[model samples]
Target: MAPKAAVLVPCLLSLLLPFSSLALTQDICVANLLLPDTPSGYPCKPKPAVTADDFHSMALAQAGPTLAPFNTGLATATVKQFPGVNGLGLAATRVDVHVGGVVPLHSHPEGSELLFVFKGSMTAGFISAESNEVYVKEVREGELFVFPQGLLHFQYNTGNETAVGFAAYSSDNPGLQITDYALFGNTLTAEDAREQGHLRRKIGGDEAQGLLRIAEILKLIKVFFGLSAVPPDGRQDYRCSLLWTCGV
Candidate 1:
């Protein structure tokens, strides 16, 4: 009977091992933003020190400045600003677009996005990387559209009035890269840019036309960043040739 009892005790302990381990494991990892970020995410804040405020945020309640050429305001709330979302695969953005405004072509390298239009209408689209095919649609109020991860996408206010929307991202800190900014807003010199454009033109045909389009877009980006001025005739007037020269 003693041998049987000992065996039963060991089996019961083994069965409870996983439960005990889970109990000790952390269920939430509120971010410690002061610490440097890691590959996985930010380090967890002290659990005892965490409060309900850590999980709540109003960062996306207001619209950001729409001073750029796109006339789009973006209020982003990610793990960096909302510490409670740390280790949680979620982030959000409030988008406000004026009439004739656009979000411009951009990509989220780390996450896909779901954009829901709650006011007015927007024309949203994404370009496929493989085929370069465009998938576009007019999304109105109460409708939603999706953009796949790592694909270039844009939102334009095609409606008569101003448009507003909210975008939810799959990543806690989805990285954003606007195509025009990547091409023109960098610290590269104009000479370097012209050289790159020349090389792309050497490919000929549509590639050459694409390079031309990039050149035209460069002026708009430069103006948005205050690196250039817009003449009364609406032509691009360059004040500086090099981005680094302007101490940007």
Candidate 2:
């Protein structure tokens, strides 16, 4: 009986160890956005402090403004805005684009995006980093599209009416890097911008052309920030220049 008890206790300990480990890994971690974000995400909020409201957002139900030059609007729900999503490995955005508007060239460095179109029609595409090849499609209402991680991509309203899309990200805080802003709108020197961005040869050393490109890029930025509108004749040019600047 003594030997049998010893064996039973050891076996029980081994079985319980695995269950404890699983329990530790399965706990949900809500975000504490008041603190600085870490590489993974914000530290978890205390379990006792969490409530139903942490998981809900009324902002998503309202439409964003579309009066800018691009006539585009975007509302994002990330771990910071929706703390319940912290450590959940997911986030989302609502995009609205009037006719001729575009969600400009940008990339998510840490996450992939899945888009579901719900209103009107649009042309969506992503450019491959390895080959600079573009995969484009005309996406209509109820259609879905996936943009892989770290690729530059965009959506443009092609139908006569407004277009709306919902995008889900694979990470709680997917970082966005807009190409034009990163390259031209910031502190990067013109020489460095040309070399790293491969812009010099394309402009053929024409100072006026370079300035024109910068002006156009600024317009796109204004459109994105809802500060300006895309001129009717310039919409197609805007689309072409954006793709070209990225060497896509």
Please report, in order, the local distance difference test score of every candidate based on alpha carbons: 0.79, 0.74
The sequence of per-residue lDDT tens digits that candidate 2 reaches over residues 22-92 is 11354667778788877555777778998889888865676677634356888889887888787677899
Model 2: weakest 10-residue lDDT segment is: 239-248
lDDT of 1 at 17: 59
Pairs that collide in candidate 1 are none
The alpha-carbon lDDT assigned to residue 22 of candidate 1 equals 18
Instruction: Quote each prediction's TM-score.
Output: 0.72, 0.69
Q: Which stretches of candidate 2 lie over 4 Å from their true place?
A: 1-26, 189-248
